[model samples]
Target: MSAWPDSSSIPASETAVANKSEGKSTDEKPSKGNREQIQVNPKVFNGETQIEVDGITVDLRNRYLAALLAWLVPGAGHFYQGRHTKGTLFVISVLSIWMLGFALGGFHVVYASWYPGDKRWHYVLQAGVGSAALPALVQGNRMRLATDERGRTRSDYEPLWNGFMAPPHRPVLESEADEVAAWYARRGSGYEMGTWYTMIAGLLNFLVVYDAFGGPLAVPISGRKKRKSDSSASSSDTGEASAFADAV
Candidate 1:
């Protein structure tokens, strides 16, 4: 038997398929629209997030996890994503605001109270701060059934943290026993200030979480506008030059 198979024995159709599989090809090129989209491997941001956009792989580091972390603690998502600078700034700013507000209100600013007059509308906004406001929920649950005489509403029965985030008693309930009244007397508008501050912190955290999940804007607003202006200026200059040449 021959050591090598004869070339003539191989079918032409089979030969062509083999040649294609072997990667020997003509000069024909794939159309641009049909070309695969560019994918960026995570590197610059030092994260695991792989992006399909060109020049925009900030390495979001698992957007959902980052978002959850950010929600749990302000700036945590950015930290996970290797964005230390932003993470530090967010942690400082958000925690500072939340702490200041909580202290200003004597730790009563973040309670989740939905009882009648104590609508606790402020808690809705305060919840945005995440964990800083979460203890209120725990405190609320602990003291949920601890009501007063006549099964009436009250903020008594101090629970965890000495009733720190407990619901406020109705103002018309009675005298010195009412926590809300006591808070009003002691803080004197501090409650309002603290509520606003914590709410702001929570709102800020919301923004931070979104940033971690969505990465930075593709093109900066200012940069995009600048590019458009520069392009228009160049176009006008070209038009003027053409007019001058025709006149000349």
Candidate 2:
């Protein structure tokens, strides 16, 4: 047999030309594993661009849980969201402040007194009264912040506030509290109603607290919604950059 020259014997330019002429593709398809690699670009916000983590998306997983948790215990919602330290701190702060106020502010007397006028005035005064209301308010505000949807706090969305704004002359609890206090002062039936009102307020507080911190995680309704890229979507949104693209 005649000796054949090895490929190395060919000139580099000739080899490249030969490879190209043979229908060889320079752009090889990546392997399956390699195809999994994703490159996200930096997010743009208000004319500023910042990099962030590549894979994480907005997770509305436990909104109800957060609310429920907050209702059950002051900062439970935060704790449920993998923020144990924050949750505990919130609970401690709200509860401590409320409790301390009650201990010092004669809350029990306010609640137990039967004068309708006294009860009404007491509620207004005790707006700073119970540890319950403040914590509930805190939890509700937290839920509003933590929740993904924007219109959740709209009073129109709530049945309790439907058709009840200024000029409607709706019977607000404050007015009722005053009525109850006056009624009791006059030895009328307002006493029981005032007590019941207080109880209902407490219960409402519980629910709000639970929802704020311990409500069930609300799953994203759509695949796209699940993939939110807003700056508020992640804990690391501020003060960091990453090699990822966010399409928000």
Candidate 3:
């Protein structure tokens, strides 16, 4: 056996083993900067926490108020969100449609009179346009006050429905009731058409309200299509090259 080496002169095998162990410890131990970097929340990488519009920061955390405002007045929510052009367009178009219907059939067209024999579903649709359609409720109340318990018009309010109802004429023959029925049918047709126009306007405004609350529709990305075209071109080129080689 050789004399034992001094502590300073350790065996080459032991020295190599010590060096390898030291290298592993240095490599495996993370630096302070890297440790801090890895501690970040993963959700932070997903998307933005706030949206900036027209130099104003909007916290998208609560949009219920905007939706309510939109319901109260068409395009108002868009205006609140800084979308002036869309809001103005929606207000103009929706109001114009509503006004046109009102002009066609007069105040009688918008009344929200819903009784057992007078259930008007069109009024429900018209109410979606907001305050512009609320006058109908007042008109309805007046009509209600002018009617008797039997649903017949009071003598005082008879003139009010003159344009809407058949003319008051004494029947000389048994067939006179048919003539009155025909007259009512003609008036009913016109009122139905006007109600349709106003209801459609309200429906359109309802869609606008949703748009205002949700913000503008997003433009679709075309990057994926471009990548697909590039890949297809590359594959075609490879196929052609192989074919040419075979031909050669």
Candidate 4:
């Protein structure tokens, strides 16, 4: 027969097995709790649609519509996406800047015109603001219709379009050239500022459009990595504290 195991070894072996079982139960408790927690709050782990509009729940699965609405009207996409605060702020700020520019330059400040090479480029920027920039297109077309192919003003359209047209460039009498120069010098800076403000507003709206198309920008993080780092730091701190207590 095999030599009988030492009586003392039996208790040690039983204790080791008991500790192993206890360890397993302790580990399983946390996993079970985690599963229950996940079941209770699934949204935290699984993505869900949660957009609401005007006190009514709505599905925002169609990103294209949101982007189109955003482009058509500043902040509108955010509004539709249930981001009321951002939408309101965008609408107020962008529309205010655009309106201020319009007021400063009148209808003349915002319209599209290609005849003057420098003027057409501004319309490209301004058009980003959507319907707000359309009046300029209408006025530009009306102005075109008011002029004949020979570059002479048509009498029938002149009365309606004269106020909207840029002053014609004509051979200035030497005596009056100084007066024309003075007038332009005084008004040029104001017009330039108004154009800049309007264009900037449109450019800003372009960003808003993109933001609406994509969900709000957020910083990304690896949750698992973060938790591991936190646990390691906590364990180190605990070891240091235990050593200090032993020294005391």
The candidate that achieves the highest TM-score relative to the unseen native structure: 1
Residue 248 displacement in candidate 4 (angstroms): 52
On the 0 to 100 scale, the lDDT of residue 163 in model 3 is 39
TM-score of 4: 0.56
Candidate 4 residue-wise lDDT, 169-200, digit = tens: 22223455542354346567666777788899
**Range of the 10 consecutive residues with the lowest summed lDDT in candidate 1:** 239-248
Clashing pairs in 4: 111-136
* Better candidate number, 1 or 4, judged by lDDT: 1
- Residue-by-residue lDDT tens digits, candidate 2, 1-248: 65988878899888878889999864497677755333323232222212223333322235666666665566666555544555566577656554554433223212322222222344443333244544333433343443334322334333222211101111214555542344346544444444444444444445445434322223222222324554356556433322221211
The C-alpha lDDT values of all candidates are 0.71, 0.41, 0.58, 0.61
Runs off by more than 4 Å, candidate 4: 1-60, 116-119, 158-188, 221-248
Q: List model 3 lDDT by residue over 1-248, tens digit each.
A: 66886867887678768879777444477777655322222322344433422222333233566666777788777666655666678788888888787666543566666554456677889988888876667656666677677655566753334433222222213354543355345566665667788899999988977665544322212212124446556555665544432111
Error (Å) of candidate 1 at residue 238 is 34
Tens digits of per-residue lDDT, candidate 1, 36-57, equal 4533334424544543222223
Error of 3 at 93 (Å): 0.8
Q: Which 10 residues in a row give candidate 4 its minimum summed lDDT?
A: 217-226
lDDT, ranked from best to worst: 1, 4, 3, 2
